[model samples]
Target: MADINIQRKKSSPSPWLLILLVLLGLAAVGYYVFRADSDQPVTTAPAVPSPEPAPDSTTGAETAPRPTNDPAVADMATEEPGGSPDELAAFAASDASAPNYGRRGLEMLMASLRPLADRDDLRDATVSEKRDDLTSATSRLQEQGTSLRPGYVAAANLIKAMQQKAYPALEADAGELVNRANALSGRTNTAQEQQQVRDFLSRAAEIVRALNQPAQ
Candidate 1:
């Protein structure tokens, strides 16, 4: 057993060589880790888009309102000397025939009889005169807005006519007065005549005021 024995040499450490080996091992580890990381691209967050505002209205164009008519309102406006001239003109325009023609025609006929009344001849007085006298009396009963009150609309219309200074309208209004007078056909007495005279006179006063003002 002693004849064939053999031994290998054991190597001794070099400081510089040992250091170099350690550095090389660290470098290899770093390179392997970096190489793996480079294979995958860096993850990034997605971007968000902004939204736009919408337009208004389903259909195009904005429309304005139309004007309306009110008779009551129109009447209220006629409180002045010639308060509703335009309204009166409109009223006048509405009628093709004069509404007061009957009254005026009767007045004309009675005016002829004034001379007979002046002579105090009650017996010889014509039928037209009697009608006229009765009309005069009823009108007197209704003066200063007292009788046969048709409310604001009629009053405003009357005022408007006076304001306009339209001669034909004035004639029509006079006819209306005569008709109001003729409302009483058969009554015979001083009281009826006197009362009607007062009303007609009140109307006369309003007309006088309207006449005095300058036309608008």
Candidate 2:
């Protein structure tokens, strides 16, 4: 009986098995890194805030937007000199003893006649239409009554002559009107009143000059 001691040889792993194990380990590590990245929160840029409006220098408040190019807005921004014709006429028609009564009355006269004298359609207007316009303007003037300065009477008379077609005396009437207006010059108490009277006279002179032209 021979005692045969058979020793089992220790087998090493195959190269393919070693490669598979290495690949599995690498795959696990890659999956954990991918999951860690996926779990992380996303970063983004911060939002920018709007700029504040500039404060007004005088009021220390935010200024309003600038006005557009609308004509009505322009008209509102810059008021008419003195006031509108309707406003002047209203002032003239008020109590006779008001402080600005005489000045406003004369201003109303100037304002009323300015459109008539400058009317482009005047030449084309019928005789009756011309008389009607003159009559209306004269009536507006007369509404001021004693509030109007003394000189307006002659001017009104001249306009009346035009309405009546009394052309011969118009020249004399116009001359008298000019003389009266000149006589009243610089007689007003205030510089403003004086300017108003002067403006009225200038406008009256323009009307007279237009009337003096040969009938077209």
Candidate 3:
């Protein structure tokens, strides 16, 4: 046992190890924050790409549509038509709304037929009144077309037949157009619409004649 005193060994963490652990923790926290910000938001809706706007092509135009109650057609009249772009759009709409020639013809005549149907002199067996009526209808249809409304084509057809042969044939044509006009008139149309319907009806006799007219 000599006077040899061994100093007790003390265990302590190395400074370098402590510093390295602190740096690793700081790096992990920074990585976590960045990852959170970069992730896309969770959404229930399917993602879709936004649409791009159409380019303006209209730069010149001379005419436009007339103002009317049909909200669908209102813009057709006033759109500052710069060129054919607007015109094309309007034309497409018109063609779609217009009545088909033979398919959707009216089932039968309404208020518009009053003038023709009630006339005792013309409504009877005499073919003369029918011819006269057909002529008048033809003129009116021409007027409508020249005025820029092409809706009177059926009426015009009736008128052409009067110029051809008479009697049984004219009567047959008259029936077709008159029935068509009457059917239109019977509908719940507005005053203006009713007027158009009436105009259509009055021209029935003439449309018959037009239909019979020789192919030209």
Candidate 4:
């Protein structure tokens, strides 16, 4: 009998070893993907825009925001001018103790005299009409029960001089109006009062200019 040589089959790779290799490969791939994600920059939400400031009602302009605690701003707010011409006139003619009495009285007097001062004819019917207004203003001031300030009295006296056709006196003493106004302004506690006095002086200066104009 011929002796048959049996060839031994080579053993296949273990299933558990193959499974372990696949798991290791999957873990490495997952770790690389996670690392790629971690390397990117984080995103943030966009910022919201601020709202605009409101406009000023009187001037029709936009006003900038001011600090509430700022002393200058506080003073400006506190000293803001109040009332209309009619109201100021009433206050001026009411009483000596009235708020802004002297200032308002002077303002009213200056306002009444402005039109008459600008006229070319002192004896025109328009002069009488304007003088009537001045008379009415002075009458109210005189009717007030309280004693008047020297500044207000001086203004009234000047108006009286105009009523009496004392042109020379008016010309010579017109500067006294501004001088008294300046003195009163210096005594003012607020910018608003000082400003009112300044306005009175400006109007008084215009009257002086009209008085000084060359005769036609």
Computed on alpha carbons, the lDDT of every model, listed in order, comes to 0.40, 0.51, 0.40, 0.51
**Candidate 1: residue pairs that collide:** 84-160, 135-181, 135-182, 137-196, 140-195, 140-196, 140-199
Is candidate 1 or 4 superior in lDDT? Answer: 4
Give the per-residue lDDT digits (tens) of candidate 2, residues 26-107: 9999999999999999999999998876665655665675768874454334322544344554454455444555555554
Q: 141 in model 4: Cα distance from truth in Å?
A: 0.8
- Model 2: runs farther than 4 Å from truth? 1-3, 14-97, 119-166, 190-216
lDDT of 1 by residue, 109-202 (tens): 2232232223322223343344344334334332343333222123323333343333343565555554554453322235564344334434
Query: What C-alpha RMSD separates each model from the true structure?
Result: 18.7, 11.5, 19.3, 13.8
Where's the lowest-lDDT run of ten residues in candidate 4?
A: 75-84
Give the number of the best model, judged by TM-score: 2
- TM-score of model 4 vs. true structure: 0.27
On the 0 to 100 scale, the lDDT of residue 178 in model 3 is 41
Candidate 3 C-alpha lDDT tens digits along 1-216: 679889999989999999999999999999999999889687698889898755444544535544588733532332223223222223323322244311112212111222332344334433345534433433333222232122233333333233233344456555555455544533323555544544453354234323324433
Cα TM-score per model: 0.23, 0.38, 0.21, 0.27
Candidate 4, residues 91-169, lDDT tens digits: the string is 4434354465554545554454544444555555544554445434344443444333454435534543453453654
